[model samples]
Target: MGDTTIAPPPTAQRRAGVWQAVLLLAGSCMPVLGSVLITPILPQLSEHFGDTPGAEVLVPMIVAIPALMIALFAPFAGQIVDRLGRKTLLVVAMFAYAIVGTAPAWLEALPAILLSRVLVGVCEAAIMTVCTTLIVDYFHEERRRNRYLGLQTVVTTLAATAFIAIGGALGVGGWHTPFWVYAVSILIGALMVISLWEPTAAEAGEPEARDRPAKVRIPWARIGVPLLVTLFGGFTFYVIVLEVSYLVVGTGVAADDTATIGGVAAIASLATAIGGLSFAKLSKLGHGVLLPLAFGLQAVGMLVIWIVPGLPGIGVGAVIASFGSGVLLPSLLTWVVAAAHFADRGRVTGWWTSAFFLGQFLTPILVAVLAAGLGALPAAVGVVGIVALLVGAAVGFALRKASAAVAA
Candidate 1:
C-alpha cells in the first residue's frame, strides 16, 4: 500500500502574543474615535462656526469627513498594506492621526478645521485597513480570528462609549476640548513600536507563497458579493450611531442636552458590545441561521422606535438595534475575510473597509431623502425599518434553499 500522510497547514508563530493583541486592539479604537469623540459637541461646533458661511453643512462634515476619506482612500491604503507590510503603515497612520486629529483644537477658521478633519480621515483609512488586516494576520484559525474580530468590536464600542461621555463633559469647556482626545493615538502608536512585530507566511513555512509576485489576480466573485452586501450592512449599521443624537433632539426628548444624548449613544453602544461578545458562540449557527435574526431584530427595534414615543421607547429601540448591528459587523467581516485569499487579505479588507465607511458616508443623505418624502425623520426611520424587514425575509428564504441544497 502507498504511504499517505496529511501535512498540517502552516501556522504563524506568535510574535509577541498578548501584548500584540493589546496594541492592535488599542489601535483599532482610533478610527472610530474620530466621530464619537466629537458627536456630542457637534451642535456647539456648528454654532461656533455659524457666523462663518456654510456652518450648517460644514459642521456636520466634521463627523462625516473622516468616513468619506476612509471610503475614498482605504483601497489605496490596502494596496500599500499588501505590498509594503502592515506595521510600518499602521504606525505612520497612527502618528498622523494624532497630529491631524488634534488640529481642530488650535484652528480658528472653519475651513481650516474642515481641512484637518479631511486629513484625519485619510489616516483613519490606513489605520482601520491595517489594523483589521493584522488581526487576520496574527490569527490563522477561523474560530480564533472570529473571536478576535468580536473582541475588536467590543473594545471599539466600549471605547466609543467612554469617549462620548468624555466629549460631553469636555464640551462644557468648549467643542475644542474633545479634540484633545485624539492625542491618545500618540500613546497607542508608541506602544505599537515597542510591542508590535511583523509576521509573515514565511515564518509559518510558506516561503514559496511569500516569495510569489505581488501582482496576482483577485478572486472578485468570492469577495465582491459580500462587499456589496456589506455596503448595505454598513448603511443599516451606521444609521443610529450617526443619527440618534439628531433623533433624540428631534423627538423633543433631550433638547440641547449633549450629556443626555451622549448617555443614550453610550447605552446603544453597550448593547452593540453585548451583541459582539456573542459572535464566537453564535457563529456556528452559520449565515443561514444568523443573518435573519440580526436583521429581524433590527427591523423590530426600528419599528418600535417609530411607533412608540418618548426617551424610554427610543432607548429600548436603540439597544435592540445596536445589538443587531454589533452582530452584523463581525458576521460580515468574518465572512469576507474567510473568503479572501491569504495574500489578498489586506487589499480585500481595504475594499471591505471602503464599502463599510462608504455606507456610513451615504447614511445621512439617504435618511434625508427619506425624510423629505416621508414628512418626518421618525417616519423615515419606520420606512427604512420595513425595508430592513424585507431584506431579512429575503435573505432567510434564500438561505433556507441553500441549507436544503446542502442537506440534500
Candidate 2:
C-alpha cells in the first residue's frame, strides 16, 4: 500500500497563509474605495462641472455609478471567474481599475468623467467578485472562512471611514488629488501578482475534478432564501451608514458642525468594525441565534432613534444598528456560501454580490419613499427597523421548526 501511494501535485498541496489573506483582504477594499473615496470631493466635482447640463444629477452619479455597475456586472464577473479562472480576471480588473479610477484627474468634460466612473464600476465588478471568490477558495475550513468573511466586513467598513477622511483631505488640493488615490490599486495588483497563485481543483476538494462536467449548475434552491435575506440585509446595513449624517443634523446638530457630525459617524463606524470582529467568535452560535440577535439589535437601535429623541438617541441608536449590520453582513455571507461547490462558487458569490449591492443602491430611494410617506426620515427608518424585527422573528421561528423536525 505504501509503495502504491501517490503524492499530490505541488499546486494541489499549496496552502494560503497570512500573505494571501492580506492581499485578498486589501483587494476586497477596492469596491469600497470606488464607492466612497469620491464622496467627500463631490462638492468640488460639482463646482468644477457646475456649468455642465444636469451637473447636479450627474455629479452625484459619479459617486453612485460604481455601485450600480457592481450590482449590474458582478454576476457576469462571477461567470468569468468560474469559467475563466479567478486570479487572472482579478489581476486584470485591478489594473483596469487603476487606469479608469485616475482618469477623472485629467478629464475636462463632465460626461467624460462620468464615463470614466462607469468604467471604474466595471472594473470594480470584477475586482469584488474575484476577491470574494478567492477568499472562499483559499480558506475552506469553516472557522477560517467565517473569520475572513467577518474581517472582510470589518476591513471594508473601516476603510470606508478612512477613505472619506482621505478624500476630504485630498480635496483641499482639488478634486483631482483624490482621483490619484485610485492608483493604489496598481500597487495592490502588483503585489498580488507576486504573492498569489490560482487554487487548483484538487485544492477545492475535487481531486477527481477532471472527470466532472465542465459546468456545474448553481444550487439555487439552497441559496435562494439566503440571497433574499441578503438583499434586505444589504438595505438595512446601509440605512445607518447613509443616514447618520442626516440623522445627526435632524438631532439639531448644525450640518456645518463637521466636527460633531464626523465624530458621531466615526463612532458608529467603529461600532460596525467591532461587530464584524465579534462575529468570528459569535458565529459559533450558528445563524439561528446570530441572525435574530443581529436584526433585533438593529431594530432596537432604530426604534431608539425613532422614540428616544435628539443626538444622544441618534448616536446610541446608530451605533447599535451599525453593529447589528456588521454581524448581519457576514452571517448572510456565510449562510449563502456554506453550500456552494467549487464549480459554481464563483457564480454563487456573484449573485450574492449583486443582491447585496443592489440593496445598497436602492437604500436611499427606498428610505426617501418611506420618508415621504411617513413625513419624517427617522420615522421611515423606524418602519424599516420594525420590518427587520419581524423578519428576524420569522427566521428564528422557521429555524426552530426545522430543528424540531430534524430532532424528531
Candidate 3:
C-alpha cells in the first residue's frame, strides 16, 4: 500500500569489484545486441534468399525471432538463476551464445540459420537475467543501484547502435560477417569466470547466509503494476527502435537509402544514451516525477515527427523520443527492484524482462494494425504517442499516491 523500497545508506557496503561490474555491463548488452545487429542487413538477406521457400517471412524472422525467444525463455532463465546460481549459468550461456550466434556465418541454409538464431535467443535469456540479477545483488543502496541501472541502459543503447552500424558495414562483406560479433561474448565470458563471484547474502553482511535456494513468497501484487506498465513501456520504447528507419524511409527524404537512414538511427540512439547518462542525477527526482516527464517527452516527440516537414524535423523528434525511452527503462527497473524482496529478485526480474521483450516483439504487429486504421505510419506513431502520454499521467498519479501514503 506504501513505498516498500529499502534505501540503504551510501556506506551500506563496499563497492562491487570493477571487473564484476564490467562483465555484467558487457553481458547486459547481449539482449539488445541480437535484436538490432542483423537489422541493417535484413533487406540484403531477403534479396539473397529470395529464391528460398517462405523467404519473405523467414528472412525477416531472423531479425525478430531472438526477441520472441527471449520473451518466452527469460522466466525459465530466471528460475535457473534462482536455483542454480548466477555465475555458472551466465558463463555457459555466453559461450553457447557465441556458437549459436555465429552459426549463420558458414551455414547456407535459411532454416538452419533461423534455428541458430532461436538458440542464440535462448542463451540470451539466461545471459540477460543473470546479468541483471547479479547487478541487484552487487548494489544494495538504492542510489548506487539506480546509477548502475542507468549506466547499464547507456551501455545497451550505445552497444545496440554500434552493432547496427557494424552489421551495416559488414553486410558489404556479407551478411555472415556480422554474426562474428557474437563471438565477442566468448571473450566476455572468459573474463566473467575470472572476475565474477557467486554473490550471497553472507558477503553483503549476513555471515550465516548460504548460497542455498530458499522458497520465498513473491510479492506479486506489489510487482503487478510495475510489470504491467513495463509491458506498455516496452512497446513504446521500441516503436522508434523498430520503426525509425522505416519512418525515415517512408518520409521519402532518405530516398530508400539505407546508409542515410542508418545514420539517423545512430544519432537517435546516441541521444538516448546521452539521456541515460543523466539518469544518476535525475534519479533524485523520483519516479513519480520522472515517469510523467519521460512519457510526455516521448508523446510530444512522436507527434513532432508525425507532422514535421523534413529529415531534420524527424531527427529532432527521434532524439526527443529516444531521450524519453532512455530514461524510462532505469526508472521502471529501479522501481521494480526496490519493491521486490532480495530473495525473489531473480524471478521478479525475469518476469519483468519477459514482459518488456514480449511488448517489444509485439510492437510491429500493434503498429501495423494501428497504421491500417490510421491510414499512415506516422499517424499510427502519433496515436501511440497519445496513448503513452495517458499512460504516463496515470502512472504519475499512482506513484504520487504511493509516495504520499509513504509520507503520511
Candidate 4:
C-alpha cells in the first residue's frame, strides 16, 4: 500500500479513497444491472405468458413496473435517508433487493415473480438516493466529485456488460437462464449489508450530524436545471428500452437469442462507460462542452440507426449515443449537487430521482403504444431519435444559459 496520510475535514485524498469508492460504486450498481439483465429475456417472457393476449404486456410491465413505483416514491427517499441514516437505509434496501430479485427466479407462481419485482423496485428507490448521498461523503470538491461519479458510472456500465452477457448465456440455455441473473443481487446485497458504513449528516453534507427527523424542503429555484436535465435524459433512455426487444424479436431475430440483444446493448454501454471515464480526466468543459456534445452525438447516432435498421448500424448508433449519455451523467449530477442549498440537498435529490424515474416510466408506455399501433421498429426508433434531438437542443440551451450566468 502507498503511504497513508491524515487530512483535514473536507479534504478527499485520492489514493486512500479507492476501496471506499469501489464499495460504494458496487453497492450502487446492483439495481441498474438487475433491471437490464432481464431486458433481453422479454421475448421469452411474452412467449411464456402469451396464453392470454395481454400476458405479453407483462414483460415490459415487469421491467418498467419497478421504475413506476420508484418514480412515485423517489421524492421521499432522500428524506428517509436523512431521517434514518444512510447505512441503515442502504442495508434494508440491499436486503429487500436481494430477496425480491431472487424470489422471481425461484418462485413457482408468476404472481410471486411479479410481486418480487415490485418489492425489488421498492428497495431500489432507497438504494439509489442513499448511495448518491454516500458519494458526497466520500468526495470533496467539484473535480474530485465529477471524476468519482464518472468512475461510478463506468462501474455500472461494466456491470451492465457482464450481466448482459450472463443474461444472454442463461437465456440461450432456455427462458430460465436470464432469471438466474438474480444471484448477483444476493451477493452484492450481502456485500453492502456487511461492509458499508452509514454516513451521518456531517458525512452526507447535510447540516445535522445527529438523529433528528427533519423535513427537507424542495429547492426548485436552485436545482431546476439539473433536475430537469436528469428527467430529459431518462426519457431518451426509456424510449430505447421500450422498443429494443421488439425491434429484434418482432423483426425476424430469434427470440431465444437473448445473447444477441445483450451483446448489442453491451457494445453500446461499453462506449458509454468509456466516454464517461474519459470525461473525468478533463477539468473544463466536462459539463459545459462535453454534456451537450455527447448529447448531439447521441442524436446523430439515433437518427442514423433509425434510418438504416440493422444490428450493425443500430449498434453503432447506440454506441455513439451511449457515450454521450455517459459523459453527461457525471457532469450533470455533480452540477445538481453543487447547485443545491446545503440544507435541502436531500429533498432536492429526492425530486431529482423522482423525475429521472418518471421519465423512465412514462416514455416506455408511450413507446409501447406507438409500437403496438405503428409497428415496433419504426415507431420505437423514430420516436427515440426525435426525443434525442429535442433533448439535445434543450441541453444546448441549458449549457448556454449556465455559461452566460457563470460569466456574468
A best-first ranking of the candidates according to their lDDT comes to: 2, 3, 1, 4
Clashing pairs in 3: none
Q: Estimate each model's TM-score.
A: 0.90, 0.96, 0.92, 0.81
Range of the 10 consecutive residues with the lowest summed lDDT in candidate 4: 204-213
Q: Which ten-residue region of model 3 has the weakest summed lDDT?
A: 203-212
- Quantify all predictions' global Cα lDDT against the true fold: 0.84, 0.90, 0.86, 0.69
Order the candidate numbers by TM-score, best to worst. Answer: 2, 3, 1, 4
Question: What is the per-residue lDDT of model 2 for residues 268-325, given as tens digits with 9 covering 90 to 100?
Answer: 9999999999999999998888999999999999999999899999999999999999
Candidate 3 lands at a TM-score of 0.92
**After superposition on all CA atoms, how large is the RMSD of candidate 1?**
4.1
Q: How does candidate 1 score on lDDT?
A: 0.84
Highest lDDT against the true fold, candidate: 2
Steric clash count of candidate 3: 0
Residue runs of model 4 more than 4 Å from their true location after superposition = 1-16, 40-48, 171-190, 200-216, 238-263, 308-312, 369-383, 402-407
Model 3 misplaced stretches (Cα beyond 4 Å): 1-15, 204-213
Return the lDDT, model 1, position 35: 73
